[model samples]
Target: MSWWHWLWESEWHGILLGRWMVAVLLLVMGLGLAGLLASLLSRFFYLSLGKTQEDITRRELHRLMRPAWLFAILLAVLYSTLHVLEFFHLSTRWVDWIHRLFQALVLLALGLLGSRLLAVAETILASRYQQANEPYKLQLVHPLFTLGRILLFVLMGFLVLETTLKVNVGPFFTTLGLGGLAVALAAQETLQHFFGALAIFADKPFQLGETIRLENGTVGTIEKIGLRSTQIRTLDGLLLIIPNKRLADSPLENLTRTPRRRVLFRIGLLYNTPETTLQALKSELEESLGQLPFTIEKPLICLTNFQDSALELTVVTFVDPFYRAGNSSTPLSFLEIQDQIAERILRTVRRHQPQTDFAFPTRTLYIQKSSTGLDALSEVSRSGK
Candidate 1:
């Protein structure tokens, strides 16, 4: 017998491909057709997005790349295998089970592929925004992408279970509600944070890139606003992850949103400073503050307090909140501005009264104790020495 005839007619137990060789050939042809379809679809997708093989990225990011093509080809091969079995055993009871299993596997594959595709899209969008220097749009993509992924998996989970396990999703979800009560009981904090996130979005007290201060004295720039928490980059370059619930419930201040920044400080001089020198110092400081481009409105300079060793003059000024010191090519921030202001104050104080000194805390001991107590103190001191 010819080798082809021998192979075709050979039977492994009750199974033979003698007459079903035609079915095998058809199956091969069907797989080829499926592959051709995938190639054409993927090529069309790449071209539609105005991407070419010569692009910076070599990977076919428009989806339906080689892996996806192989994925589809594999599914097609599995499907053909099932049909090939039907050609030989047309009344097999297992055929329906095979079909159901195929459906479930396909759903699983689709879910995973969709998730990766979503991630790819997100990466592409973020890259584009970053290149364009639109960080506001870039930050927005992360949270939105996260939300989309969650919804995708939830929906895909239902479809997969309904197909594979033959579970009725509607009734399952209804029963799940009762079980969810216990789950919710255990995750009350997570739920609170979730709702707080919703509140943040709705109210928009602050946005990404704005500076905010919490009542607990934490100051930082808003970096990310996620479903459960917020990320802040503090001035000292530390990253703080704060729960959304606490952020929403607390008294928060949006520093960047203010119209002006108030600067208040007390300048102390020796108590022996003459009244004329004090008045002159106050007048010049006020004039200097008003002439500054950053400061707004009349500054208040008054003799507010008399400390133990010095007289205190409180200086209050309202500066343009958005001001960045323009003294140099690179503008200075709030801290730098504060340093410069201190220098200016020192110069003014010196220019007004060269001989006057700034005060330091001092104490004078009064030795007018009773003679008996003094004698006892002297005796104790003599003994100690």
Candidate 2:
């Protein structure tokens, strides 16, 4: 016999040369058809949606389409393989296990495809959300997206285990229920922070990039908000990590939310300064503050208190809130505005009265000698004479 005839006639396991060739051809053809169909669908979407080749939607669709094509091809191949085995009378116990293993693989592929689709959906939603101007919504997007991805993975795992592996999850869930208390106790702090993060999303007490003051006297700009903690960059250039639970529970102050900042100035003048000068000083201060670019309105300048050493004049004004950008036409810090106003007040005072002195702590002492002591001194002086 010829070598080819011998090879064709030989059956190493269950399939002969003819059957193996047919199965290979079937698999190849199925995969090729799947690829063609995917391409056609892609072209259809690209044309109908007015999307370019490089558009994100087109790219994501291309990425998602390949796995689906592969999954379909794989299913067809498995079915074909089973049918071939049955026709050849080669269906055995091991073949059944092989079929089950193939089914499991198919299920795994499907799960992966589902995850990809979910990820794509999440990306779209996040993009939409980020385009919105709402600060609270922006803050909630990341945490919610992360949570959705986690849940998607969990569901994928459960579906794979139950449908493909035929594993019973009843006992597993029972064990989890029995150990729920222990698990909760062990993860108490983690749970607290997790729930606290949720509360922060719901309540929106503060947002990223906003200046906040904590009850513990930590003043900083919010850098990041996480499920377990929040990161803040303080004025001192130090990064502060605070637990979400504590941050949410504490008395938090959102300084960025204020429309304007109130600046209080206490100016002390010499006690002996004239009342007319003080009034002039007050008027000058009010006019100067009103002209400042940072000032929101005319200042409230008045004599507020009579100190033991001097008279105190309080100057109150409203200015744009500090450290926030784009809220005002001019970009200036709170300290800078304060310094400019103070310098102007000093210049005005000096111009009005060059010799006017600022108040300092002073005491006037009067010594009154007793009458008897003075008469004795006079007698002593006369005796000496």
Candidate 3:
């Protein structure tokens, strides 16, 4: 035989080592082929993204595609190596065991790849909806994916038990079914909380870091929202934990949604003040308030009522919900703005004091006696003298 033919036909002195080297060479070749195929597939995939190029972000592409390519390469290399080993002279039992081990490894890799792909899909969809301003579009994504992952692992376990360990999976599946039922029964309350969280996500009643006031006057900032419960940081700096069910069912006002705060108050003045002066005072208040920070809207100042003792000037104004004070990035509350307005009102009123006297409850008394009674009193006094 020729030299090349002899090399191909001859098992070297170390037959096992030669077979191992041959398997390794086949594995390397399979890896290269798999890599090339993966690159083509990825290229085609990106090309297919005609209009929806941004559908999968670069980060997501890396997260999903990298794992997929690696999985493919691993499968190809392992499969090629195992198949090559079958061509060699080996004990039947050993070959069978090796095949079973390979099968188990394949099952694990497949399951992991499936789980990761599902996660990538969910993440892409979630981000797409969130970007489109449909915050609730994929509200059920988390719970569903979590459920999917559990099912995948169970299935992988069943496969491994049946194919790798040569065990009966029938009884295990039956047991799983009954156990699942029992678990459902025991976790009823937990399920309720989970569904409640789903509803909250769907409705978007409040968001993290937002201030909300509940029906029962519970005011707090949303710290965290979880499947079982939501945590709130109360105004008093206490952490409040509320079950998701309760929070989703209760009515809550999103304080952060208000663009501005409206304050209405009445300032009473003496009825004796002139009408022109009243008009001037109202105009003055409008001008003064307009000068304050975040007082962009013209204030409403009108004569609202004529009381028993005074004329009431009612003023309604809107102040921006939050304001940065004196070069500080921290926002001062609207309450402080209300206080500042009160000061301005007082100063404006004081400018016209005495003339614009603040009205108070007052009474005037007059004493009178009849002329005949006075004359009779005078006669009695003269007789007594």
Candidate 4:
């Protein structure tokens, strides 16, 4: 017989060649149809969920759907393979192994899906916080989401071990506990900072973009808060990394939180100046300060003390919060505003009382020289008589 005819007519293990070929064809066709159906369903589901969502989220969902579709197709193939094996009287051991492998794969896919969903949720939450102008809450998103993802994957791994490999997790956990303790001891400092970061978030001593002074006298603006440390940009433009533990434990002054900046000025007038002139100057200075746009509070002007060489006048005022440092949009800084105010006071004083002089340290000496020899002798004889 011809080879083609022999192949068509041949029977192997009580199965005809043509029948076996048909079964193989049906398996291939079933798998392809099942995969196509899964893909269509996944696309439909994604479209339904993402119809009103952002394009970015839609794209992420599309990517997530691909794996889900792949997993579905893999499950279909696994089921078909088992059906074929049973029909062909294959070993039960192989079927059991395949089932376990499929279960493990499903668990892994579930972990990935959970992580993707968490990422999507985080993205949504971050955007909402940004829109609401609550940036401090946004800072907690990444670390918290990452920790959750880690936990999810760890749980999935344990499930795979116990369910698929039929491994006992009781002893594993005991070993893990001891190992975890060792790791905790090794990373003591890191753990301290990690907990300190949590405390900072909870306590809210300072926040991002706030100017802070540390207990150690380091002054800087908070740039970033991280898992282990905080980044600070100093006034001199240097970046400072402060450990979270120290930052949380130390006294921190949040300079930006104040409603206004206080300025104290000392003015010296000549000691010979009249009290009336001093009072008039003080009144004029207070009036001028009241007119200034940067002054948030009424000025206090008084002669605080009588110094050795000058009349000490104390002037206290507050700069508006808008004019404080770190407001780049405002053309004047706190120091610049103080300087302008001081100059204005001087100019006003000069214009109003041109004769008034600013004081300087000066000393006067009086000496009465003894008279000439004849006059001194005559004065002494008169006194003796």
Q: Indicate which candidate wins on lDDT.
A: 3
User: 289-364 in candidate 1: lDDT tens per residue?
Assistant: 7777778789889999877677788888888767755465543466765665677678888886554557777655
Rank by lDDT, highest first: 3, 4, 1, 2
| Model 3 Cα shift for residue 250 (angstroms) | 2.0
* Clash pairs for candidate 2: none
Weakest lDDT window of 10 consecutive positions for candidate 3: 376-385
lDDT of 2 by residue, 92-174 (tens): 87666766766666666666666655555555555556666565666566567667767766776776678767888889889
Clashing pairs in 1: none
- What is the C-alpha lDDT profile of model 4 across 146-237, one tens digit per residue? 99999999999999999999999999899999999999999999999999998998988888888887887777889999989999998789
TM-score of 1: 0.69
Deviation in Å, model 4, residue 102 alpha carbon:
2.4
Candidate 1 error regions (>4 Å):
1-39, 42-61, 64-70, 81-91, 109-175, 287-300, 306-309, 320-331, 361-385
Q: Per-residue lDDT for 131 in model 4?
A: 75
lDDT of candidates 1 onward, in order: 0.74, 0.73, 0.78, 0.77
TM-score, cand. 3 vs. native: 0.72
- Candidate 3 lDDT at 173 equals 76
Alpha-carbon TM-score of each model against the true structure? 0.69, 0.79, 0.72, 0.73
lDDT of 3 at 169: 85
Candidate 4 lDDT trough over 10 residues, lowest sum: 376-385
